[model samples]
Target: MNQCLAKKVSLQILLVDSYDIALNATAQLVKTQYPDGNIISTRTANDAINKIVNWQPDLIIMDIYLPEKLGEIAQTKTGLDFLQQVMQKYPKLNIFVQSPYVKRLVQIKPAIVKHQGGFVIADKNVTSQEMLSIIDGALKGFTRIKGITDIYIYPDIYEKLNLKPEILKLLSLAFNEGLQDKAIAAHICVSERTVRKHWETLQAALGIDCHELRNQGINIRVFTKIRARAAGLID
Candidate 1:
């Protein structure tokens, strides 16, 4: 084993969620990976803010929706509100927000990006492997979360291209997995000929010529991914 892997580094992590079962289970899972790390769990945004201020954790894992009712007369504070506050107060803090709602992610992504902090939004149902990867990436200063491409694609560029929803989905699949036309057709329940048509439309719209790239030993699938990232379609 590498000496660094054998040695444990001390870290402090905070997990904020309204569900007690999920909160404790996530804490235990993280504890196993970071044996020397401290994990704190909180249900409400207020408690999370307090812990964040006092503990100064190295990473924070939060839910997009958190209970914020203080009383009948008190104004309710949302998880997004808390996130904005945290980002403004501690610009360099690492934060991971989980939610299954795509619309919510779309609404908050720009703000997170503008904050320029180590922040990532992940699906709530992420697998254990994906969860670990996201956490590791955040600690290493990566802002993009795995399997969430909609947030990466610039809406302005997408609109400028005037691509249909199906075309956008196809491009995302290609960029993410580099799937061949047949494989993509199978996944989308379409014929291979239809897939080729869509690919040709995308090439014409994006000004990419597959035949030209092939002559230079560059596969179109790989080139599409590179171009998407260059165009801010994928991070």
Candidate 2:
């Protein structure tokens, strides 16, 4: 709840990327969009962290793979590590994360959402207009963007969760598209009863009770979608 975000006044923004061209291009784009905004660009996680501590920017647009040197080592810290540090220190700061690897974004998204701060994730190839739209929405306190959420999937999640492919498919169909059990069964070429059996198995495997989530004021479908993404089944 930064007042600047609500008031739409002059803002401070930090842009962090390893690539010079992308970093400059994004900074220029932000300057064009918010003429009064102060834009600071950095190419390493260490520099970005230093700027975060000293400048305390209102918004940060950063890559997810900033490989930076530490002490004698050539490369030590990662952008995800930087992100965790930033979140721990500035829980309310808005952050926009861009990465070429969609799976990495998916892996980190749940943590970002759990922080309950302003956050958006998009591919590095996102159009300038789309990037601006995402920035505008995030500044207005929108935590999730359709463009990002629609394509998020952590590829290693299923293996990590030890989930069966069949169950994963069912969850993806149901959560991703809001399909009912019967519709899911139709889509998978199975009987509704079979779908129900698989659903029960899946619940046991995930150790999630839909009723409990409902009582916690969580939408079952949305919760399932998060789980699906976490399990790398969103595709």
lDDT of each: 0.71, 0.71
- Candidate 1 stretches with Cα past 4 Å from truth are 1-9, 69-77, 145-235
- Model 1: clashing residue pairs? none
Q: Across residues 31-72, which tens digit of lDDT does each residue of candidate 2 receive?
A: 889987889998888888899999888899988667664332
Question: TM per model?
Answer: 0.57, 0.58
Clashes of each: 0, 0
Query: Candidate 2 at 24: error in angstroms?
Result: 0.7
lDDT of 1 by residue, 1-235 (tens): 5767644456889998877887988898888788888898988888889999998988998885677644322211366667778888988899887765433444344466766557776777888878888888888778874434554344544444444446655775676577777888888889989888887765655568888988998888767776665544443
**If candidate 2 were superposed on the true structure by all CA atoms, what would the RMSD be?**
13.5
What TM-score does structure 2 among the candidates reach?
0.58
